[model samples]
Target chain A: MEILNRTKKEGDRTLLDDLAQKELSRRKFLRFSGMAGASALVISGVGLTGCVRDDDGSGTDGVNLGSGDIGILNYAYALEQLEAAFYTQVMATPYSGMNALEGEYLKDIRDHEIAHREFFKAALGTSAIQGLDVDFSSINFSSRDSVLATAKAFEDLGVAAYNGAGKLLVSADYLTLAGKIVSVEARHAALIRDLISNGSFADLASLAPLGANTANALDGALNPPQVLAIASTYVRNRIIANNLPTS
Target chain B: MNVHNLLHEIENVDPEVYDRLDSRRKVMKRFSFIGKTLALAAVPSALGSMFNKAYGQTNDDVKDVLLFAYLLENLEAEFYKGVVGTFAAIGVPAGPAQGALTVIRDHEVAHVAFLKTVLNSLGVTPPVYTAASFDFTGGNGSRMGPFAAAASNYGVMLAVAQTFEDTGVRAYKGQAPRLINNNDVLTAALQIHAVEARHASHIRQMRRNLASGSLVPAGVTLQPWITLAQSGIDTGNAGANAAIQMSYAGEEVVSQATVPITNIGGAVISANEASEAFDEPLTKAQVTAIVDPFVV
Candidate 1:
């Protein structure tokens, strides 16, 4: 599990600098796991494990999450695909009683999600995985309650997924890109939350803050596994993230 | 720091010999030096004048990022606290705007607490900027700006909230790359980023709910998401358009990877839809420009 992954910018040194400074033989490895989603554990005196791809050599044919940063990008891309498909359906058959303004918000978000999905596709080019197959059978698109509820869930899940994955990216550009998209997802999340229960947008309890939070000051942050677990219910394909970096 | 000059000596060495040298320290030192030089040369010179002394901190890069966030969050928390704390004094009744503002205020307070905790844990003291440090009315010392009615009026108040929250979202996105090396910081900033986005969205939603007569004239039309129309954002026709421009200046970006999305994706989205779909980043300079007026 990821321990002390929460950096304590000790004076002038960062955790990454410390890790890089340490001698080659005694490497400190960080694995993100615990506290349901946002905790990271630092492990020492061991070989990095559980990072080999589960795919059969060729990564394209199945749910293979390449490796390293590409794997994380693909993970985000996959979620965007799910969101885009979901919104496309929502617009194609809007639930009853969606006003022009409400309908406009949904349409803007749908375009944004589609842009997001395709941006990753262009950015990744060949490294991108096959288009994901979705399962929306459980969601009743005709009902506002069902559509809004499902939309809220997806938006919340997208925000958390990025929160957890931000630590895994090695490239600064990609990290910035992920940050750019995640906030919009949050905006969508807030709108959907408001659409459901007027003031519930930021009312949910957040465990992200350190110390006691009397105001429940933090927000949602889901690890890849936790997100995939929920997303799996909506995605029909068998997703495998074995090659993702844990340290 | 020239790579060619640095590699001259190693060019003659066999691959096997270079591998056995175990010179990780030397290599990292050169790499870091190159990174520093690149960072300096990369930032556009035209944007340099906008930098501020308020955020000038010399600590771990991540520490600086956290403190910057603390400044913005403080500004937001105080803005909300003033109005939400004195709902009646401001001539506003308890309604949806009041309810929405309360929720946003709480989130801002939470964000401030979170940033301070992270700064403390980083072994750095958080800078304190009291609410008196701000001048929301745009009137320093002796006068109040046109938006002084912001607190007294729900419509004006929502306009101010929209600018602050949108800037907050962009500010977080801008600093994320600097904190990327530290996963904990990156993840935390992103979490806050999304919350700010939610704030921006709800503020827009609230504004949209206002009666046409009570609406904030932001020049151009407004939506919950960003779009590529700056005609009204900077036209000064709306409430303090000049002040609000820094927060939303170039938000109307319609291109990604130097190519239009609608051209290739077959989505058939309009030009407005393209920019509305994505939020752009803003540097500390742009943020301080929009925020400093409120911050004394």
Candidate 2:
């Protein structure tokens, strides 16, 4: 099949376009967007630009997550999808006698996750993956114990994913921004854990095991493969091999 | 709208195109010599400037730091395990403090296990052992070992434990950035690091409650932000150089020191010396020098 000879349009718009195009790589991309860049993902494909076509009973067609920054955007997109799904489920069927405070807290979590998901969608633009169909078969959302347990798991896992990936970011600015987000994730983990067990929150994970800890083992924590596996259930779109750093 | 369509779209696309695009981007990103030099020059200072930034050691030069982190996690896990076991065995006195300490100990074990898994997945063999010598319950370096019974000086021991826990929080924060590319590892480590910070805060609060007055015990340094000044005395004289006296949140908080987690206890600490409550990373030379005595 012949590749389309897409013509480059030139004008004052082209100057902005050229600069925007230059900001497609991981480090350079964040340099251009700062914290806001998370919302400006550019999609690459044949026909679909950034529009999320409201298809009849079907997701929009897939877009190419171009190399580097595009790949990172998709990675984030996948995570946001997972988080948004989990939180949405949590809000849908809260545990028995779940207080007004708990209700508000869970709602806040759902909102944060939606924001993160939407940010990736906007940032990836035409390149972003369409909405994923997540499987929640394993979770008994009706039970408070089950929901809280899952939330704890996700909150902890999200924090860990961020921690492991922060060093992988080539951009200092992006790294800084990720740090802020990870800390928030960690706070979420702590709060959720505390809600379940109260004073037992800090100790339940680290101190009971052994050694003079002498190192931080708290906050949210997870490595990549672990996180990917946990998140895999929600992301239906296959991640294209984009030559982003994995190790 | 649905999973099947998303998969079908993915299937229709050529994976090779993604590969080609990715490689092209990487080739473009590869350094102009000027860019390479500038990045290298900026790295050390940028990483060093903040605790969180310090973990952003992503380049090839950071293998040592990564290895050090692995070793540190191992050492910490072992320490907490020993404490929990000892407390359980005695079946002596149990209270809220002991209960909290026990939970923290369990978390440490999980952390150690988690980090080990990360290293294993990475195909990196972590340092097998650390010198298991610390005077946590005060007898000498080797006196109590990791699981020695809580002594009459439980307060002092708790203070030291709290200090070490706080230091861990800072050290992990310092190491976060370097793992950004490895989303899996970064995520796991961040989870544990946040837990450590909470542990530190709890311990610090306990110490404050115990003493009632603003005075902390000798050889104990609360995080820099928590002052001993209310008790009518300056606890330390490191001046600007103090480990716990750095500015955080626009205030001179307790300096969250970022020493290599492993080396801080086994090598740099003298049995009698106050555990230097500051972020002092031993240079490779210093680490080698201190570890030489214990290494076979």
Candidate 3:
């Protein structure tokens, strides 16, 4: 499939080249180190007093969730952290026998993920989750099949997360944005899944066909608890428990 | 409990909430009421009163809804860019299928920007953050290779895409009811939703053809052909051991052995019909739970 040709022709190196540049920058590394140091200091200051409870002490610490919106935002922030950590690790030590093309693509994925993580960080500001230590003990980053399989799972789950969250939005503007982003996530999910299981792209009927499936099932949507299970390993703070709105 | 008993309970205990909802429902019934009142009386005052009434009820709902949409789009944006990035790292050339994916990605970007704009207009603070990274495979604490390893294996990608797209379609459908009051917003969401359906069908078709060599006749025009059968066959989780249960528009339709898409004249199964019936709306809790882990 002449992807290299197409990528070159299209000048779509924004994601790839951008990350590659950061890898070369001493300044970027220093900045990241500083941020890590700051995070440690902040974590220590709030470590004891941050353990807020929901009358049951089951919820995550350091989160002062006042409303349903805050709860939902926290949920999203957690997912972003998982994705960010995964990509960061992927870039740090790419799998063995990785081809140049594969290395390039993985690097791009890392860059994009970093961007997503940072975007959420900026948007959530004080509301965002502190960098929780991620445990990648489950993934085999050295194996080709293992990495792809994990990627597929993450992509599919990510798409479902966005799809599931759309209805909770009341604002038209937010709805529009959700619509736009979900479509992209859908594409990502589709592509990654296809990469994992060739020819599985058109196999929804076997998984959840129409008449048997609602519109919600098509995009791999998932609820908060479900999303939490998938993202749990990557996040240290527990999600503040809140009752989801029932139909 | 049976639906009959459920209905009885709703009528007996929760009459007020139901009645309040029913009263608002009537506003749609009498379309000319607002127009007539404005024309016959003090137009400005009547309009002002209408706005006032709507404003009070909408502010809270709008804030929550907007936040929900914003979060959804942000997640999607991060996911898609992840896809593009992941694939590029691998040697997989952006193929014909990749083009279709690109269109989908563009649409998602547009959705995110549009939602941000909408929230801005509403004077709501948008939650913008970094693009969340993704694990393309189910990383099991082992070293990994290129993100596009599935490119070498057709079964994996098809399964992943089918699941993801099916979820997207269902999620949008599930959310449609909440948006019915705003015609423009509803139309916009559905349009994008439908487009997502098309993407789902294309992926499903590719998988089906790859698996069993079942070809979708070229140039089929039926929406149901693409949506109902092909997309269904590819994305539905109806097996006895399926992790998640599914339905279409509240109907429990079973998955068929094959995509049965007959043309308008019954000559051959058309593509459009297969594409149109790919709708899958999910329950709200199901969606929230699925995305919760990612919510940092």
Per-residue lDDT over B1-296 for candidate 3, one digit per residue giving the tens place of the 0 to 100 score: 23335334433533322322332322222223344434424434544455345333545555565566556656655655655566654332466656555555565666677767767887877776555333334222121322234333344444445445556566765666556345444544554464465466456545544533222234422111223333233222233113222322332222111213233213222333222312335666666654443444
* Candidate 1: true contacts recovered, fraction: 0.59
Instruction: Fill in the DockQ of model 1.
Output: 0.29
TM-score of 3: 0.41
Could you list the iRMS of every candidate?
8.5, 15.3, 20.8
Q: Tens-digit lDDT track for model 3 on A1-247? A: 1111111223554433322232222123223224324422332343222223333324544343222232344455566567757866776778788776456545544443444444444443344445655667888988878787777666556656655655544333344434433443444445455555644442344324111122222334456667666676655555543433211
Top candidate when judged by DockQ against the true structure: 1
Identify the CAPRI category of the predicted complex in candidate 1.
acceptable
TM-score of every candidate relative to the true structure? 0.76, 0.47, 0.41
Per-candidate DockQ versus the true complex?
0.29, 0.11, 0.01
DockQ, ranked from best to worst: 1, 2, 3
Indicate the residue-level lDDT of B2 in model 3: 37
For residue A85, model 2's alpha carbon misses the true position, in angstroms, by: 5.4
Model 3 fnat? 0.01
In the range B173-252, model 2's lDDT, one tens digit per residue, is: 55655554455455556556666655654665455556543236456544311222211122333321122222121112
TM-score-wise, the better of 2 and 3 is: 2
TM-score winner among the candidates? 1
Q: What is the DockQ of candidate 2?
A: 0.11
Please identify model 2 stretches exceeding 4 Å from their true place: A1-60, A63-66, A84-93, A99-141, A163-168, A190-247, B1-100, B106-170, B178-296
Runs with alpha carbons beyond 4 Å of true place in candidate 1: A1-61, A206-216, B1-59, B140-143, B212-221, B229-239
What is the C-alpha lDDT profile of model 1 across A1-247, one tens digit per residue?
Answer: 0111222235666433432332121121112101212211221222122122323433543476654566788899999999999999999998999998679789888888998888877766555677877899999999999999899889888888887888777655567678778878888888888888876776556323211133535567777887898899888767767556564
